[model samples]
Target: MSIPLDSPALALRAALHAALVADAALLALLGGPRIHDVPPAEADFPFVALGEAVVADWSTATEAGTEHALTLHVFSRSGGRAEAYAVAEAVAHALHDAPLALAGHRLANLRATTAEVRRESDGRTFHALVRFRAVTEPL
Candidate 1:
């Protein structure tokens, strides 16, 4: 299909969202398909939510490209950080180096960059932040 010129950031975000929801490992970790771009209120525990994203110009002299730094958040209520970390691991494993079909863009590369698991200020919720770095070129 021919996709017209579009924002590479949005295209990549859509592709990432679709890929996360479709991963069996991530689904198993979350106990269901609970990945969301904007999670609903009263969402269940141990779910994944799309978080902050930063996109920057990566154009060359004759080529147009973009660099994306995206983050995914895992929320859990387990007694410890283990559950949150596990969910984060699943997310990283599912996304790193995985081939994703993006509209109006071609994925040059995607890689898990960093992760941090900590207890929320409420002291009951464990939050895991997983970040990824990706590059895309206009298709």
Candidate 2:
């Protein structure tokens, strides 16, 4: 199937969301696949969320390319930062170097950029933000 020239980013987002949710390590942290871009009010801890994607059209006459800036958020309410940090590490492992089969596109590279684990103002919840850079080329 051909992907719409303007919609490749949708395929890339879906591929990435699936990859993170299907990862064993990530599931172990959350007890099930609970990744989301927008979490519910009663969302559980240790969950992974795909915050946003900034995609730039990088195309040449022969091929189409996209440079993506992706952000992931990990939430936890454990006694300490261990649980949250562990989940963040698993996320990094799952995404970095992943060979995602993006529809109508070829994954050129995916790498973790930065991550920070800190307790929220409430001092009860931990928020971890992980950033990544991805490049995709049309197949």
lDDT of 2 at 52: 78
TM-score of each: 0.94, 0.88
The local distance difference test score of model 1 is 0.90
Candidate 1, backbone clash total: 0
lDDT at 92 for candidate 1?
A: 95
> Which residue runs of candidate 2 sit more than 4 Å off their true CA positions?
1-6, 60-62
Clashes found in each candidate (C-alpha, N, C closer than 3 A)? 0, 0
Residue 72, candidate 1: how far off, in angstroms? 0.8
What's model 2's lDDT at 106?
88
Model 1: per-residue Cα lDDT over 3-94, one tens digit each = 34587878888888898889998898888898988889999888988888888888999998899999999999988999999999999999
